[model samples]
Target chain A: MSESAIITPPLSDDDIMKLKIGDRVLITGKILTGRDSAHKRLFDLIKEGKSLPVDVKGQIIYYVGPAPAKPGYVIGSAGPTTSYRMDPYAPLLMEHGLKGMIGKGVRSQPVRDAMKQFKAVYLAATGGAGALIAKNIKSARIVAYEDLGPEAIRELEVENFPVIVANDAYGGDLYQEGIKQYRR
Target chain B: MRRDISHEKIKDTVARLCIDANYFLGNDMIQAFKSYIENEESDTGRDILKQLLRNAEIAEKEQVPLCQDCGFAVVFLEIGTGVCFEGNIIEAINDGVRKGYTEGYLRKSILSDPVKGKNTNDNTPAIIHTTFVPGDKIKITVAPKGGGSENMSEVKMMKPADGIEGVKDFVVDRVLRSSSNPCPPTVVGVGIGGTFEYVAFLAKKALLRNIGERNTDPFYADIERELLQRINNLGIGPMGLGGRTTSLDVFIETHPRHIASFPVAVNINCHVARHKTAII
Candidate 1:
């Protein structure tokens, strides 16, 4: 309910501690992008004891597969896809120093527990507002799996990218607590 | 008496509809958002709704997709018995989809195979449902369904004894369990009766109706009203962060079922609610 928190990752432990469920934040700087297809690949790599294409250390992974950038735009319709699809891979990524996840919807309990244990947090942008969200992304380029097209892993440079802290390291969950306050 | 419609004309119309529907959200939803903003108690919910309105404006002005998940094209074709087309109708429709998704810069989300999976790349081979009606004109409706919401849809085979209350409980519980995952402020479509596959289609088709457009049958209209109220009260809110606008509307479409069976389907649509229709 207070003013927005500004975040630029690789977020520090202290930075993760400061976020609370329901707090608004404007994120700047770089973030990694991946979705269902990319998560499956990452999960496979982890199981095979192979190093990832990009380091997971102190990074934020955005659950997105954005439309191809148009002629004059840096990105196109960049918005969070649903997050639960990445649940199977999230805890392991967190263990490897994945400090943050950006997406929409509720996460599994294991993922929430991982956030608390690993000093990580989950944030969600407004879903379905892709065109508006795309404006906040300053640059986007694929970093891996080019053949997967939209589902490819990419790096994005964003500014004032708005999101709400959905899960925090302190075991706070906005999706659960927020609904509790209003559900009749 | 036969009426001729050219394949080229149909293809062009479908292509235009595919692009236009993604850019311009229906006015009914826009008005609903405005009204919901005034009444929504949660600050976050109101803010999200405002962002949605702005998103719509940006998409319209810039001629871009409102959501990155451009959606699976679910086209409904009602071809009149009196109407005639020269070339392959299905081919023309697919060609139109290929043209629209490619030329309009929409994302290619369709996989060629469900399990073996490779991107069709052009968003083709649309899920087309065709019917033969009495008139000479053909009616086409495109409802772009996103995976997030479609994944939440369900079909239930209930016993005759479970009755209406069972139907209500199942529908409400499905939404409750799904909560934020379907992108709240969803549109709930209920299909009662019919075979398994047909019931699912009825639920999906029901979503294409304009906001607040109730069923013509009084009994079913009341059911829609009750379902809407129940869903909104669940407080899933905008994007499921919580508020009073969990669902914009509930649509119920019913058909005669076999004496022994009562089947129901719930098809949830995200707040995007993209559907466009044209008559030719």
Candidate 2:
């Protein structure tokens, strides 16, 4: 991979769409956290024509359920949960200007297609590296549904949050490519 | 002949075990992580492995849970027919789970109902699977199963003709299909024979085996080795970033069943593999 390829500008949908597989992304700024429960609630809000707890427009959603924080810690071990559980609701979120997703695992085809149409990217965080990822989250505050436990939505400020381009805007999937390269 | 076991003892043990298992990655799992870091050909895979090892070290030193999802407390109990419990075994287990989860500062993951969502804030009542084994001592094994890998686990019933080959194929297929979802370089537990439920029980029991340990039976051991190789060959790699070493080990536990039945179950465990055992 070229050094230029690794350096992606603060992405807009157009910029995200041009990304190729194997690109390394350093995401800054705000990201929203949601897991199974939060996804359901978000979709329900949309269905009810009620404003979502957090606006998703041109934003990235991370599929994470963080542990409770210790004293002086903003958040506890915050890692990606399985992405497929969010698969059912992701495309709908994408239609509302969701530009990227941060999580692990393969996404459904409709989600992938939505990315192509919306120029979104799917970034994969290391699955078991929760504590490491948590260190990158500078601040976290529960924005909605605090009763959902760890599955509640939280807005976070991240710095150099490490992630890899799993699904690029052009419909290239690293998982499929990785398996095909190694599968005998 | 059941020996009376104290509720306090069970509770204390459960709490200590929960904190220890979550803070410290088992020796076998650590060794597997080290091996993958050294041997993985992909730079990305190696980097991820390094991060995992670092995460384990930080969690241990800081006395924090390894993964954010401390997981649902699953207790596997083997009750001795010769020993009687003074109080309710189920209640003792639940009490212990509550104390452990509370004191450990682990996340409360259990819900009262799957459909009507309600948080059981103490991470209980625990999922207790008990059995009457021929023994004088009671054994408790605690596996704090994370949600990511548990979501990916599946069980299937195959025709008797599928045999060992079919079992192997199914296990590999599941892991491959799981890809990065379950967190690769995983531990795969295969349970064969018995009825459907028994098959699943055996599969989970198989996960209790230490990584890289072989089955006592030579034939089964050989098959385990072959399955491990085939799974690694899938190249799901560490964290599925792509390279070799998708699975660190494959363990199978089996039992006899009816002539016309062939049942197989696959339980996938992530790299964390947080579990500890105690005998009393």
Candidate 3:
């Protein structure tokens, strides 16, 4: 598939709606990172009606828990963790104006439904490609949940971070479609 | 009857193995990717495989972990009865893990408690399995197992009548349900015949086999081949984006079981399939 480029932080509904499943994309700009622990913390704050450390409004979150950086490096291998772990928390964030998510793996029905209704898109970064993906991250700093270690909420400035649309607002799912096409 | 092995040797070797395993994707894994790339019909599948190869190269070149999930350091030890250790073997191994994860710059992914969710900053408490053998040598293998694929593993006690056909179905079903969750193009490890817990252990140990190796028993070997084809036929492809290569290999290990019980366990290893070994 050919590539399309999108700059995040202010990803619009139109930008998300235009992305079809299977279209490769290069995402450039600042993105926030969260994984299972961070998601759970955010969910708890939302349940209590407390303001999140970082606003979810019109933002893209990548499900990643990065390795501790070595000396003189901005970040270590920063790659996507499994997305299914975040399914329960994703919809609520989407409701709060989260426009996009990047992770690997299949998501649940509720998550997909939320994406469709909320006009959010799910992007997939290749699993186990952390070293390759980390090269795209120019800088990374923890924004919140510092105690979470690898699971800390980090803000990363990425340049041409590669991804593919796995699920889009218009109801296309790359995982199901791709398997259906190839499975015998 | 006993030859002494130093704790320092074990610690240093374990540390090195941890770093090496995370940095270098094993030759067996690299070869599997190469073979998949050559044969994958879908352009996307081929491209994904190529990217994995490149990812591995970049990891090695930069001394970075292949995946941010450096995983729980799983150590398998075969200690010969003819040899004795100079210190606490388990403690030495854990210390090695602590040093390796911290000094190697690998991610510290282990939590202090499964439910409490506190980070074990140094990635300690290596899951060590030990067995005693007859020779004088000590063999240690470090397999850094990621959570994604590990979570996808399953163990089921089947009725004796379920037979080989039933076993095949269960293994394939597990992989199918897993889809991209375990990071597809997975190495499927099937353990059959042992008691429930033992069978699960067998399934995990089966994953330690080199990808190109097969079960030596003809019956189980044939089953391994058949399961491999069936899993790849699922079309989960590389990273489950869809393609001809859902599973690179299927390894089956079996043991004698009670007549009434038929236990089967499936442990899937993602494409990274990281492990390294040293004999001392």
Candidate 4:
């Protein structure tokens, strides 16, 4: 399949609508990195009516917690973590204008429903392909919760980061579709 | 004659093994991928396999980790009856893990408390499973298990009537449910018979076997081959993106069971399958 190039941080409704299940995409531009702990904290802040550490409105959040970078690298081996753990917090984030997510694994029905309602999309980066994925991230810096270690929130400037459209705004899910097509 | 082993030696050795296991993909795993690439029919599956090969190469050449998770450091120690240790074995293992995780630049993934949500900082308190043997030498095996795949493992108590076909269904069903979550093509480990707890242990121990190795019993060995073919036939493919090579290998370990219970367990390992052994 030919790869599509998409830029992030201002992902539009039209851009998301054009994405189909199974379309490979190389996303470039700024994205936020967070995983379980960060999501919990973000959810708490949202509930408290306090401002989040970073502006998540219309941002693409990648579910990852990278290894500590060695001396010469901008980031260590960084790849998508499982997405199901984030399902509980996702609908809340979508209501807050989060436009997209990047992770591996299937999402819950609520998350899929939120994507359809809020016009968000879910992309999947190859799991266990961390070293290769790290090469695509240009730079990274912690934006919040540094004490969470790898789970800290970081703003990453990525270049041509590879992902596949796993869930689209129109209720398409690649995990189910791919399995149904391939499963005997 | 009894030989005394120091904690420092165990500590240092554990540290080095952890680092090596995390940084280098096992040769057996690499070979499995090479063969899968040739056998996989789907373009996407083949491409994913190729990318994994490249990822391993990059990790080895650069001395980075094969995956960012690095995993919980699990140690299996076989202590000889004739051997004596000068210091605490558990302490030595934990110290070794702490040094390995910190010095190797691997991720510290353990939490001190499951509910409190605090990092242990150095990934200490390694899960050490020790068994006593008759030899004079202690053998240590380190298998760093990732949570993504570990989460998919299962233990079930089936009726005796379920029998072999039942075991097959359970094993294949577990794999299908795991899909791409455990990062197929996966190495499936099945443990049959044994008591409930022991079966789970057997399942995990089965994962330590090399992908090419088979059970000694022909019956179980044949079952392994059949399960492998069945799982691959699911077309879950690599990364669940869809394809022919969902599982690289299936391993089965069986033990005598109680009259009333048939306990089975499935342990899944990602393609990396990082394990290394040392004898002292």
C-alpha positional error of residue A132 in candidate 2 after TM-score superposition, expressed in Å: 1.6
Q: Candidate 4 on B4-91: residue-level lDDT in tens?
A: 9999999999999999998899888999999989988877778889989999999999998889989989899999998999878899
Candidate 3 residue-wise lDDT, B8-106, digit = tens: 988899999999999999888898899888889888888888889999999999899999999999999999999988889998899899889989999
Interface-residue RMSD per candidate? 0.7, 1.1, 0.7, 1.0
- For every candidate, what share of the true interface contacts is present? 0.77, 0.64, 0.91, 0.69
Candidate 1 structure quality by residue, lDDT tens digits, A1-184: 4668688988889988988888899999999999988988988999999999998788999999898778999888988999999999999999989999999899999999999999999999988899999999999988999999999999999999999999999999888887898899
Cand. 1 TM to true fold: 0.99
| Cα lDDT, model 3, residue B210 | 93
TM-score of chain B of each: 0.98, 0.96, 0.98, 0.98
Instruction: Arrange candidates by TM-score, descending.
Output: 1, 3, 4, 2
Top lDDT hit: 1
CA lDDT of each candidate? 0.91, 0.84, 0.91, 0.90
Give the per-residue lDDT digits (tens) of candidate 2, residues A46-108.
989898878888788889888788887898888888898999999889888888889988888
Considering every candidate listed, which one attains the maximal TM-score? 1
Error of 2 at B275 (Å): 0.9
Candidate number with the higher DockQ (2 or 3): 3
Clashing pairs in 3: none
Best by DockQ: 3
